[model samples]
Target chain A: MAERKVTVTSEVGLHARPAATFVQTAAKAPFDVMIAKVDGPPVNAKSILAVLSLDVEQGDFIVVSAEGEGADELLDQLVEIVSAP
Target chain B: MGQVPTAPPPTLTGTGVSPGIGYGPARVLVLDVPEPEAGARHDGDARAERERAEWALEQVAADLEARGARVGGEAEQVLHAQAMMARDPELATRTGELIDRGVAAPRAVFAAFGTYRGLLAAAGGYLGERVADLDDVRDRVIALLTGRPLPGAAEFAAAGSGMGVTTPFVLVARDLAPADTALLSPDAVAAFVTEQGGPTSHTAILARSLGVPAVVGCTGATAIPPGVPLLVDGAGGSVRLSPPAHEVARARRVARAGRAVLPAVSSTQVSGSHLFRRGMTADGHAVPLLANIGGPRDVESALAYGAEGVGLFRTEFLFLGRAAAPSVAEQAEAYRAVFEAFPGDRVVVRTLDAGADKPLAFLPPSGVEPNPALGERGLRLLRRHRDVMNVQLAALAAAATKTSAKAQVMAPMVATAEEAEWFALACRTAGLASPGIMIEVPAAALRAADLIGAVDFLSIGTNDLTQYALAADRQVGSVAGLQDPWHPAVLDLVAATASAASGAGKGCGVCGEAAADPVLACVFVGMGVTSLSMAAPALPAVRAALIRHALAQCAAAASAARSARSAVDARAAAEAALSRT
Candidate 1:
């Protein structure tokens, strides 16, 4: 189990394209991706609306976590995708 | 269950399609399309190296074969019969042979496919005139290439009844693809609800046809899942899930039982309501009241609303907002079901109106302008996707023959008279009886006179016309006021379009939002429009308005409104005149 912290840096917030793209990327990977609000229980990474419903917008610090063989590597990539400012 | 059984509420409101009222228990049909496959990859060899090189070749043949299979049941043995080419063993074997030759799977598939397709075309003919066998061949080729027959909707049949209860209910979903939406049973389902679909989604159109009720674009539908004890009243666009016992009891109390139904009384026609008969002029000329139906659920509403017939039965809803296009036979079954619902009445179907305002991911995204009003859409999209249009028209034509209804095929977003002619010609070639055009573009309205001969009928789509005329963005809240159809300009366009149809003795109908308003019925009549088609619930008010008034008065009101300088002035004057009637 590993956790990666990244402040969502996509403009227009994580609700629209960024959120969808995030879910799509997460869903594409084999490992389970967990996304949550700054201080909330993580929701499934594949559900676009759920991720969006969390209301994690740009400039907000959010926690990304994963549990799998490549947890660290996967978290790094996920962080990279999320942390692009 | 009674020598004198009780009934449900005297009134039920829903997303009124085709404006009629049917006081029956909710028949909830949850239309659902199959979700995209779980496995997907971006920038990866989802396929092995052997399958990558000739992706083009294998893809094309596969596309055509899949297309053939998809088109199978749409209309007749003719159009979709072309889809049988998917099952063509030689085509498959040849393409497979190409792949075995080290040319790569994609190229081998595409290369062999290309040759076979050329043969089908050289011998079978082009889109409009292609023989049945050839068309199916093309469909199969495309279907195979696309991997799936374009992402569309389907049906969602609940596994079973819980609590030994067959209570009338309305089914709701996020959105239904065409395939799953097909599973919706007209007899069992009362209504439909969806959160993420537009007016053009197949589920919406099916709801309109089944005469069931549907409310789409609700968006938060996962919250309303299957097996939930829920109550939906489409007329009100509201749903009460797990209602209190009293509410269920109240709904049951208000429910009108017995599908056997009472026979029509001679007085029933004249006494109950005058809306179904298209409003009359003070002079007593009959006006057609057509229904602007989107899905099967709205069919019942359309009939109830006193719609003389369906005026704008959008066909594109079957394919839009999905992963891919629909097969011809798949489209045919849906079309047949709609036309069948309104037997003997006129059901004017517009070909798929995709692109601009509505886009499909499967198609290469043609660069859309910041404001799509000026971009390519409607007939332009049809021109580009001739394959889709051909199958749709063919399905409509086939469905018409099967349903025993007067199903006239038409085109959407016709900007030029030539476009009308081309669409009409496509319809005719497909064996559809009437090839008509929808007058949504200002250009069509301006040149209505020239466009009449090109079409069997003319339908005034006032909603878009007003938007375009006023340069208003329909989605923009600031410009909401400008979307008024009563604008003298929109009315004049209707009048002009009507006049054009009248001269040629072609059918003229207005199935836009303007037609649904009770106050505007008279004005539409006055404008020389042959019919006023609208959503079903508006029928009662529209019928009452028409019955209470006369055609001469409506014409007079239209004239005064038309003389107004602006849309605002025109609406004001029209409203005042309608109040008097």
Candidate 2:
């Protein structure tokens, strides 16, 4: 599994459109993906409810982990989306 | 059930905040969605119950997507985003989990959303706003399960129905949320009547901006049965339920005449022959007409409608909804865009006016405030976050050097001479020469002389002045009648501030919703206001009204209005004086 921690910086954290967009992107990957608040249990990244339930807000750090052929590339893409304003 | 008796036709009165008249079939908006019965269990068929819940969720999601497809642009984007929330896989799984526990579908769906709602509400500000959108989705699903029609969802459903209303319908509601109102257009909703909200409420403001007739604070507005014809006299603040046919005919005639005159005054494109000139009274007193703009995008319309300069450039657009403040260079570029729009003209930029009703995520208020209207906002927030103010001032200074337009910066919510002096010194230190303060607070207006001594100029935000002067919350519709700028007490403050600015040999400008009123614009000029800044579309009417009267006439009207006992009386006095001259 490839895991990376990044801070959410999109002002509204991962709520509403941002969270939905994030999940839609993660679902497109052909692998199992999960996200968790720092030191919290990981939830399915493809689940909008699970992503929102984590309650990741701006300036809060979260870890993204996935196991697949392109796990490293997928984590990088997810990190970029979460960090960009 | 017993047959309900036909009640006598009633006339509900409210504060008429927007002008004009409209009549159409009442389309009462329902806002509240009741929670399903708690812990209500389904029959032991777990598989069947889960399938029922899934079907409702899918139906709601499909309905939202259909609405989004029907209403393109921003509304479509918002609706489509909501559909995603409806189809949230995690929400479905959790809801299924609850159904498996023998909970009813509606209760299960409600409980599943509640878990996420707590987290978002705690985050506050922008995230807090999402809670409403989330609740909206939840309500739609629950409504589906309970076989009840959703409130705001009815409009979309109606539009999707093949047999929608051919004529625009009158929107009647207990109150309108700004978010919901943003999606409605004048073409769809002919007028607005709300049981709550004052003249300064969001419903009233949106009506005026959309050029729709509106009555706010209307008693029992929500009781008007949907599909019953309603005659709304927006200027009179009255709604006649099931008005006589003859009355409707007469009102339609008057409304037609009113509409015919509106385009001549509002649509600059339609009146292509209309010349753009400096704003002046008939007696040749120059009252510079300026536009109150949100961002650079509004400049074209402002200039098209003959805006001599930018009067009040609200910087909130750049700061709101952002996780972090923009870099000085980025801020300067945005400021430069507005300056470049009007070369050799004045652009008075108001520093970020966030807090109270318009809170920002990055700069949240310290604690829960009982009354946010009285909380630390505007300059007070900047004072706490000095770096924010410094970067903004630096950006303004940088932009000024790159453009020909005269750049003037002002601070909002300044209460004392000390704050004025501090802001002035900071602007000077940041290499900006022109620094001013808004006279919004009653304290600032009362001691305008001392503050004017510190700053270069003064701008009166009558909206805040009226709210502060009358001790009424601008956001509260119940006390909206008290939030009138025409109140003698509010006029007294304006006169005091203008007189002080005149005495100090500094320019005084009016840059609030009050300036948009053509009659009040003349009153402002008579009170020694050197400039009037308002929304772009309102410029032409104010110009025409000013050109129709001389300086002496305006001064007389202003004096007459100032002596009146109440807001209504003051307005009548001003109108009588202006017409008599």
Best by lDDT: 2
Instruction: Report how far off residue B2 is in candidate 2 (Å).
Output: 20
lDDT of 1 at B438: 84
Candidate 2: residue B91 Cα off by (Å):
2.2
TM-score of each: 0.53, 0.78
Report the Cα lDDT for candidate 1.
0.60
List, residue by residue over B89-185, the lDDT tens digit for candidate 2: 7888989999999999999999988987887788665566668778989988988888866666566345324236588888888787554554454
Per-candidate local distance difference test: 0.60, 0.83
Docking band of candidate 2: acceptable
Q: What lDDT tens digits, residue by residue, belong to model 1 across residues B74-135?
A: 32222222222333334455655654544444344445445544543443212212232333
lDDT of 1 at B197: 48
Assess candidate 2 and give its TM-score to the true structure. Answer: 0.78
Residue B128 in model 1: lDDT: 13
- Candidate 1 chain B lowest-lDDT run of ten: B152-161
